[model samples]
Target: MFTGIIEETGTVTGVIRHADLWRISVAGPAVSADAAPGDSIAVDGVCVTVTAPPHDGVFIFDVSAETWRRTTMEEWRAGTRVNLERAVTPATRLGGHLVQGHVDARGSLTDRRESGAAAELTFCFPEKFRKYLAQKGAVAVDGVSLTVAKLTRDTFSVAVIPHTLGLTTLAEKKPGEPVNLEFDVIAKYTESLLQFRGTGERELSEDYFSERGF
Candidate 1:
């Protein structure tokens, strides 16, 4: 799991495509400082395992066709900057919400502009995932955990601080750029429980509605 907090910026050194698989190499200093074979790393919010561990601050990961079909990494070429994060340990503080490093869906950047002190980034989520979004809810855009600032039928927005742009590949995002998105898993579970409740309209478990625990 990840915290959706970017640790370092890595640059693509090579992309080797071999039929159904592609091997990508990136150079990251902090994330690769103690890296080893079989470790997991988050490259632009997508969890990839280390096939060739960092040698001189470089790491390599193999991407299959399934991953290519689901993420923007297929569009990556040499010199592309990517967000990199090593998996957090049990002792690490949970600064951000739980991130599975699994990309649920891909979103396209529909609009971007400066909103006074911050940048307003709006991404259009497909209709299938629209139900998972809500105003002020959590959304992971390219590994960065951001709050949903606005919501529309097909679009949602987030306010990006200057530091966010500087620390991750989101700074490179422009119109039409595809980003990996993971909605809050808690929301999904909550909605499912609510739907089940609404079906039978079950009564309270205990004297729960006694006005502040009675």
Candidate 2:
């Protein structure tokens, strides 16, 4: 798991395509400092395994066809900058919300408005994922954990502070650019548990808890 906290920005050095997967090499000295061949790294919010040990501050990852189809990895090319984060350890602080590094769906930036030194970016996401979003809820965009500052029928906005903008790739993003989005895992799990009511189970409600002596 990841904390959706970007450690640094990495540059894509090379991309080699094959029939089944594409080999991608990224240069991120900080994130790859102690990375091993099997370590999991979040490249722009997508969890990719290090295929080879770091060499000269470069790390290799293989993107499968399925991952490519569901993410913006296809748009990546040489010299592209991407947010990078290493997986969290047991002792690691939960700086941001829990992020699986699994891109649920791709979204696009719809608007950007400057707010003093910060900026609010609005993105339109898939309709299926709309139910999982709420005002002030946590969401990971391109692996940067942010809170929903506002919400609309088909869009949500996040406030990006100067620090986040300077450290990650959000500062370089423009309207209409595609972004990888990972909704809060807790929201998804809650929805899944509520769906169990369809299996002839009792509906979950305040009275259910009250009756249980809560």
Candidate 3:
């Protein structure tokens, strides 16, 4: 799990292609300072496990075919700048919303409006994800947690303050650029429960609650 608070920006140093997966090396000194093999890190909002120990602040990980198909990993190459965040620990502060580092879908920026140092970005995602989005709800874009400022039938807008712009990659984003998107996990769970209830397969009973100590 992660808090969607970007620790630092990393640069892709190498990309080795394999039949089923691609090995990627990223240079992030801050996030890779104490990272070890098997540790979880969020790279551009996707949960990738560390494959090897850090070497001079560089870490390696493999991206499977499924992950590439679901996210914007295909666009990654050497010199690519990516948002990086280490997995949250028990003592970690929840500075941002709960982020699983799981990308649900890929979206592209459709418009960008700047006012002084702030900016409002609009993106259009798949229609299926529309049900999970709500005005003022949480959304993670390229691993940066932001609140939805406006919602339309197919697009959503987020306001990026000057602080966030300097800390993350949002400031460099341009219209038509792809980004990884993860909607609020809580909303997805609630939708699943509602659908399950409507199925009438099995209803939650007092006995069930008692058994689980709920």
Candidate 4:
């Protein structure tokens, strides 16, 4: 798992297409410093395994046709700046919320405005994921954990600090750009459990709640 904390920004150096498969190379110093062939890396919030050991600060990953269909990978090209984060270790600090590096859905930047010294970016996401979002809740946008500053029926906004803007790709983001999104895993799990209550899989009812003193 990842912590939704961007360690560095990587640039797509190349994209080689072989039929429906794509082999992508990203060059980043910090993320590739100790990366191995089998290590997991979050590239723009999508967990991709390193195809081989780093070569001159670059790592390669293969994207299958199905992964391409489900993500914004089709929009990526050479020179695309992407957020990169290595998987978290047991001893690592939880600087951000737990991130599976699994993109639940894709969103697009709808608006951007300056809020004091921060940039407030509003994004329109899939309507089905709306129920998982709440004001001040955690959400991963392109692998960067951010709090929901505001929420609407199909949109949410986050205030990006100058530091965040400088260290990651958000500084170069513009309106209408596609972004990978991962909603809070806890919220999704809770919703699933509630939906399956008393189905013999597990009971989640008044008795269950009272037992837990909820």
Deviation in angstroms for 210 in model 1? 30
TM-score of each: 0.86, 0.92, 0.96, 0.92
Q: List the residue pairs that clash in candidate 2.
A: none
- The residue ranges of model 1 lying beyond 4 angstroms of the native Cα positions read 190-214
Candidate 3 lDDT over 1-214, as tens digits, reads: 9998999999999989899999999999999999999999999999999999899999999999999899988998899999999999999999999999989999999999999999999999999999889989889999999999999988999999999999898999999999999999999999898898999757778987888898
Q: Which scores greater on TM-score, model 1 or model 2?
A: 2
- Residue 108 miss distance in model 3 (angstroms): 0.5
**Candidate 1 local lDDT, 103-140, one digit each (tens):** 88889999999866569999998788888888998888
lDDT of 4 by residue, 57-78 (tens): 9999998987787788889999
Task: Give candidate 4's error at residue 138 in angstroms.
Answer: 0.5
Error of 3 at 214 (Å): 8.4
Which candidate comes out best when scored by TM-score? 3
Clashing pairs in 3: none
**Candidate rank order under TM-score:** 3, 2, 4, 1
Preferred candidate (TM-score higher): 2 or 3 = 3
lDDT of 2: 0.95
**Stretches of candidate 4 above 4 Å error?**
198-214
Clashes of each: 0, 0, 0, 0
Of the candidates numbered 3 and 4, which has the greater lDDT value?
Answer: 3
